[model samples]
Target: MQSIRSLAARRLRSSPSSCFTATPASALGPGSARFPMAIFAAQLRGIKASSKLQQESTADTIEYSKLSDEDLNEGLQRETSESGARKPFNVEYLRESMARRPHRATYDFLSPGHSHLLNIALWDALPLEARAGNIPDSPQSSASEETSISQFFMPSASAPANNSDHELPSGHHLVYFPLQRPISLLEPDGTDPAQSPGVPFVRRMWAGGALDFRRPQNMQLNGARAVCVERLDTPNMVMRGGWGREKIFVDVVRRYGANVADLDPSPSMTAPEKLLALENKVWDDADFEERRTLVFMRAKDDVPEEDAAEAAKKPKAEERIIKSPREPEYSFSFTPTPTLLFQFSALSYNAHAIHLDLNYCRNVEGHRDLLVHGPLTLVLMLSAIRSRNTNSQVSPGRFIRMFEYRNIAPLYANEELRVCVRRNVQGRAGDERSVSEPSARWDVWVENNRGGICARGTAVTHV
Candidate 1:
């Protein structure tokens, strides 16, 4: 096999170069003079030999040191050798599982509810005083320690007394739930244990998403049930740098209400009676729920465009740089570290490689460094907006109704970032609040140290 160095040299030599012709001896100055035909031919032959030797010396080849394609993917390289190559993504397989089974999670009031957990999440997320501009750090009390509190009071590991449930704030549900199973994400088909040939090991990233809160979620301090219904929509292709960025969206509807059975554990209750109790609903109903779209992004080889017209539509990220706004009503800056990334991942039970595996990030996804979580940026932006309400209250008669965000560029760890939010002034007709415009809209974005916007979006709130 031709070594990489040799290949590079050959490629260079093959490239177009300046016109070259030996200068005539007559053009030479001083003692230089033309040679006889026979002598010139002999000299030309000798010169050609010398040139060949020099080329060989300059083109010295070195063996490729890094793992070969086969070595890096030894077992997987030949898995589908006889079957040719399989597709990198199985869209049909994912589509077939469109109707996902519902899942339920129950949380106790004192289980360091979303509020405390989110504050704990900030411990690693907040920037240092040296960089974050005196932004107060979260309480030193660790989430793990808070979680252990319930265990300590439990009479035994098997059974424990129930505590009153607390209400979770908007967007807080994202922090409380356990991480989704990573199986279908990596192996959608799961027909084989090992990946097939030509099937790239794609890394999943948290692209920004939208959340719609229907009503306030009050935790059943006495133990309420959260019924979560999820559906995996058909994946769409998002154009990235010469690649087809697959956007996989999962729609989740979480309904938090009373657990009728737990509300009254009557042993003598009949099946019909229990069913009736479960059917009974009041303020706590599915009407007051939240719908969330969790988007996962993966890169695939760019599909060839049909023609120039189609190709012209795909513009690079640089083309849209001017669209990001600069000035904002409020801005909160902070620097994120790898420690925060690790801690946030642990808190959210997220094991995405781009956030944790530097090798996978560089070798597979082609990132310069570990990526900061997109959800973390969104959380920080929301937190910054919430901080403006000095009352330290969440529901102030006005609440954010809908929020949509997207990741513009990847923000690496330890980078300084500023989260900015501006109230939309487009529809404002007067200084005084009016019923005609009961809701307000705001734009939110995160900018890197270089003032490049890494993420941007808009939010709608009903005052």
Candidate 2:
């Protein structure tokens, strides 16, 4: 049996959500499918040792050395009120509160359309424009045991090669993740009272968040020799409540970019010409036309139901069916299942009822099936690009400096999801000689079975 601490670490490595472990799938009981009895055992025997390891790895003593005494006092004053009784929110204090080992996440983007039937199946899985009507009639729409993914579980050491030739897509880092202290550390009355103070009636939850994409990441280059730092500024906290429930809203800002291998580092700059190239990649002519068509269709959809019916009864304008773009430079499709959701939830220590409770999702949340984790889709997108970048011509040491994304819509279980990325047009002025210092950008998006873009964003890379 794996030690509890090791198992927790393994689970954390696989999913960035929270630190919760699941019993082997075989151990799942029909009645206890949603709530396994094994998790009720409160004592995690090896957690103490693991806590020590975390402390040793994440202590901020060295970082503290870089701060001046005056600045240090300011941070302290900001963290504690005048008498040091009430805890004032401090940026440095918050960063120190959430500390853990550098995160690593790995994913295997199972290929689509490998088998003959699978191709037809994948075609049918796409949204209308993407499928291009190639789906054979009566082709199997159901998933089979053979089609299930075999490598959903990723270990820490399996972290995708940061030095790969292909630049990973924006928003890929969510595949692996971050932390809060152990339960014992969070409750002063428990183990080490001196380490943490207890706060009765305090509740915390992951409110939603957003990412701002400043530039693309060069997957072709590696960042092993580069120094990367993520700065988390203090969050603006707001309080709101109604219907006997109160919530705290936290708005945080995080900035991350790469620098040279020097002891003192600054933002690694990208060449202006490379930036121009990335900024220039636009949709092909056909794609632009297709988008206009889709936009028109969408506009008609917004008409009131009564108006739509009347419009349908009247003479319609000539419909222009614009041909959509075919295969992109990088594409991968996968079916997310209940098991995948459960594993992800367990790995992230998420107990949100809507994710696992069918009744809640259907009755309370009004979702058709268990909802797919939104972050999971972004991870799949980035993973596909990373997989492609491994074979790309770009050099190593190009790391993803920033990625920004938002959920345009919700995704459900057992849906065939597609991730696609195409390099923006090359710079007109720069020759192929600038390949080594290439600054590339990609138009990245995730499409549904109906070929509708559910989420769209860009990935920029610099060397």
Q: lDDT tens string, model 2, 1-463?
A: 4443365446544432222322111211223211111111111111222345434534534575456545655665555442133233333442333221121111122111111222232232333233312221223334443432322222122224442322333443332222234664433211211111112113222222333332334211233222122211111222233211223332222222322222221212122222212212210000000000000011222335765576567532112212226557877677877877776565444445556778767764446777666656655544444443442444221333223344455566777767887776433213232345555555667776666666655454443
lDDT of prediction 1: 0.44
Give TM per candidate.
0.54, 0.38
Cα lDDT, model 2, residue 326: 53
Tell me the alpha-carbon RMSD of every candidate: 25.4, 19.8
Q: How far is candidate 1 from the true structure (C-alpha RMSD, Å)?
A: 25.4
TM-score, model 1 to reference: 0.54
| Predicted candidate 1 versus true structure: per-residue lDDT over 51-135, tens digit per residue | 5543452343112113353443343344323212333443322322222111222222223334444555574444321121111
Off by over 4 Å in 1: 1-94, 99-110, 123-167, 180-202, 217-225, 234-323, 390-398, 425-437
The candidate 1 region of ten consecutive residues with least summed lDDT is 16-25
